[model samples]
Target: MEFSRRAFLAGTSALAAPLLLAKCGFVGGGGGSSSDDADTLTFTTWGTDAELAGFRAAIAAFGEANPGQTVELNAVPYEQMFTNIDAQLQAGNPPDLFRVPYYTFGAYAGQGQLLDLGPYLSADTQDRFTPAAWAAVQNEGSPFGLPHHTDTSAVLYNRDLLTSAGITTVPETAEEAWTWEELTGVAQQLRSALPADRYPFAYNWQGNGVTRWLSLLFQADGAFLDTDQRTPLIDSDAGRAAVEFSSSFFSNGFVPANNTTTSASYASEAWFGGTAAMVWSGAFQIPDAETTADFEWGATFAPRNVRGGSDFGGNALVATAQTAKPELAAAFLEFVTERDLMADFCRSASLLPTRADLQGDALTFDVRPELAPVFAGQAATVEPEDAAQVASPFMSGIIPVLQDQLDQAFLGSQDAAAAVTAMAAGIADATR
Candidate 1:
């Protein structure tokens, strides 16, 4: 993969913004227990203000219930999670009960850094949450992590802008969302009516471009990568189609031409200021968008592919193998994941708590109901089960290669097929 000869003005904030990655782990221990069997614990997690607040609310009861135990929150920048985790592990000190992203689960579990909670989970416990929501930690044959929640995007649109462009109709179902051809027609229409300085749509991260670049990947269809993890699934025809579809915006002119330097703040500001009519981002961004938009705005499921798809990202709670307080940590985990507490947790964070009951009807026509389409699309779309696995900060460093090389396709330098070929080579190179 080749990078455009350029510099990005956006400050590198250690994106923990989310990317697929390898894995890393950490450990944490609280004060020793009065008894040998007692284990003290500490925890860590990542997210924006609303998410953190919601999590705090969920754990409040747990804290009160176990006043005698020590529970600490370790807030680390999402981007540096893996790096910080490694440094701590090397230093012989780490948080005892920390969160792990889906991507890192394999690495952490493979390294024995994260204590497997499989033996601890009973069939009754397993049935408490939706199987789909647990996509993060469910590997080949065993479950390595406990899913707490999930994240997916919706198209945040400017109602006024749509009306101005005479595109007043709103989609009520995924099928109603625009088709790629139809989307391009709108982009052309929007450009003709709007100022040249304005863009029709804006999105964060690089993969959305990839998603647009291709229609789908063969590996995803049936040959899903075997346990070996060295498969050429993404380079298939369907994969290339999906890759090109995502990149078409830059290649086709719906998105800004000079996109490498386009930062998250730029897109958010554009969406709010009306310079951009639509923004693609996870449901959690509602609070951010709400605080900034002037006119009416709302979310809808993203446009469909041959099949509808959306990226999934989320967190998992796990106890470390050497935790001095497993019982206390386990209690904390159980408390936060309880159905009663989970809704409050999801509401505060604007997260779709993984608990089966909390993931469904609990979100409609209430508590920022505009986000319902995002979750609905997630549950219905035929998406890769391992979405969170791609969000690990551990493999973040490698994504840039894939990002830059495919950026060419986005810029129309190469076709989607070539771009993905470059991506496969890049992933192999990075892993080696």
Candidate 2:
């Protein structure tokens, strides 16, 4: 997770252009003008060069296949994407189709800004997606988007480091996966065996870090929100244990003192620099790790407690409610998400496809041979039951409060039980 300078430049440029357009009162194609023309469709999304390239290839393929239809792609930087889309929708000029982060889909759909896609979905199309994939875009028994691609988190370890710590076997399957206590014991061993600067474990300790925490809560058989998704459940017994287990890593010095301030790049640096033995990260890191690391590394399921589950994070395609050409937008969405095109896109972009059938080795295993199965295995653990319980519109609003209280517990300002209780209280207030 090193952010390339090119990505930063592209993000800044994309960010500035939208603000300039808003300041000039130039509402581009508001009031559904762009979607009214059957020959053309506007699609908005954000990605890096590789992702944009994959998308462009798909768009070109769609144009060639449809013969008179033109698909225009508007790609922004990842950082400014959601804000820019919010602005465009507010100005009443959203693209015919746009990318939605699964977690935020509920917020926009709840506002009646996105088209309910249930009518457009057929049995055949629905069958193409995995249950977890389909569950990600639905709200209150209606579909708002179509699945694009997905990924789940896993623990990547430095094999050489582990072997040096007198560990011969690494957990390769869920049946053999380490428990939280077992993982902490191994981390302790590595802490003593490694150099003074090295820590035992690290993760992306920003917003994504909060996702990892949620996974831990699930592994402890806890829920963030109740079955209705409107009630806060962060004060449950499982929640307290999850928080205490996580806070101990920091309090016991298994994690660095400056972890809260550390960025993803710093964590990657520690892992790649051989100062850290393992990283709790998503499957997207496999390609980068294979390219840069000199030492041998492997990935496995995230340590399990009572049960195991991983966070399924990805983007999906949705049509705006203002789209005048609903059929055309739906066609384009189907075109890009078709089985062959999606498989190619996932292969080219090094992403995990949302299709259950595409989980074969022919796509990613050929590239990063060692780590692909671990990712695939982790993805298999992301069940529809977990999605129904964990994914919520309130999540976007409550994450900041949850993160703040967790940080306080980690830094010793509040005890774990108190922090968990406060987080639940804060979420209850927000939802009310």
Candidate 3:
């Protein structure tokens, strides 16, 4: 949830280092002997202030429920979490449990640094989660973690701008989403109506912006990696089309010329400042928009080319391979993910819930009632196949390469076809 350009760039460099010496057997460290000391479990996560407070409160509740158990919360800055965890794992002393992003879940699971949660989960429990959220935590065929929370992407539009531009019909549902061409036509109309300094779209090209590209790729019916996750499929025709379509917005002046600058808040800034009519970004923007913007605004699924899809971003709770008490760790995971508890966490943290059943009914943020359904709809409608593309372990390696190529394409240093080919080559080399 605390994604920043600096943090993501730092993580790319840190993740390239080896985290584990080798894969070992599944059995974890033995549970501590029954002394007078309470069973101590460590939970490592990254966040500050309000986010950290939410985790601490949840852990305190868990401790109170299970009287003699004590769970220590280790809070790290977002930029240092991976490096810190990698060092702990290599030292053979990781926290009993930790929170990890979906992209890194595959890498840790592949190296056998995470406990397999598949055996611990019941069918009914698994069914409680949205399918896409459940699939995001799996490595190969096994689950290494439980889906904690999710954030999906959508198109945030200025209702006043649309209305001023004579656009009466705006997409309110996935089924009624605009096509790429239709969106372009609308942009053109806004361009004529708005001031010259304002653009029609605000494209985020920093931090987890690669996920934005993944959404466009999926919408074009392209996969980032093959089913095996060993081969790169980013050079396909659909992939080329996705990149080309995205680049065209900037090249044609539909988006700001400086859109490629690496600022985490650029998208929101542009929208709130009235420099742009729309922003394709995550659901996290909903809270910010409600508090900052004076104009009438609404959200809907991003424009569809071949199909409707959005970037899936979130973290999951996993038991470490070095946990001394697997049962206690699993219990903590369940406690945090409990239906009512998770709803509270999501509302307090201003995040999207992972549970399909709780999304609409349990969400309590009352600031933007209309936008809630849009975020919930995007979260619930994630295609299982599209989620699988993002869940690939290969993505952790391919992301840096893809980001570089995307920057080149956006800056006109490379053509979309050439950039796609370079991305494919880079991914192939990384997987090998």
Give the whole-model CA lDDT for all candidates, comma-separated.
Answer: 0.58, 0.74, 0.74
RMSD to the hidden true structure, all candidates: 9.1, 9.7, 7.9
What would the TM-scores of all predictions be? 0.80, 0.88, 0.86
lDDT of 3 by residue, 217-253 (tens): 8888777776555577888888899989888888878
Error of 3 at 137 (Å): 0.7
Worst 10 residues of 1 by lDDT: 4-13
lDDT of 3 at 233: 80
Runs in model 3 deviating more than 4 A are 1-38, 48-50, 261-265, 359-364
Residue 345, model 2: lDDT of: 77
Residue-level lDDT tens digits of model 1 in 25-136: 2132444321232433566767677667766676556656655444567777888876877776667566777777555565676566765555544445556666455544
Ranking by lDDT: 3, 2, 1
lDDT measured at residue 30 in model 3 versus the true structure, 0 to 100: 53
Candidate rank order under TM-score: 2, 3, 1
Best candidate (score: TM-score):
2
- Model 3's TM-score against the true structure: 0.86
What is the number of residue pairs that collide in model 2?
Answer: 0
* Clash totals, every prediction: 38, 0, 0
Q: How would you encode candidate 2's per-residue C-alpha lDDT over 311-381 as one tens digit per residue?
A: 87778899998887665666677778888888877776667898878875644743575676777777777
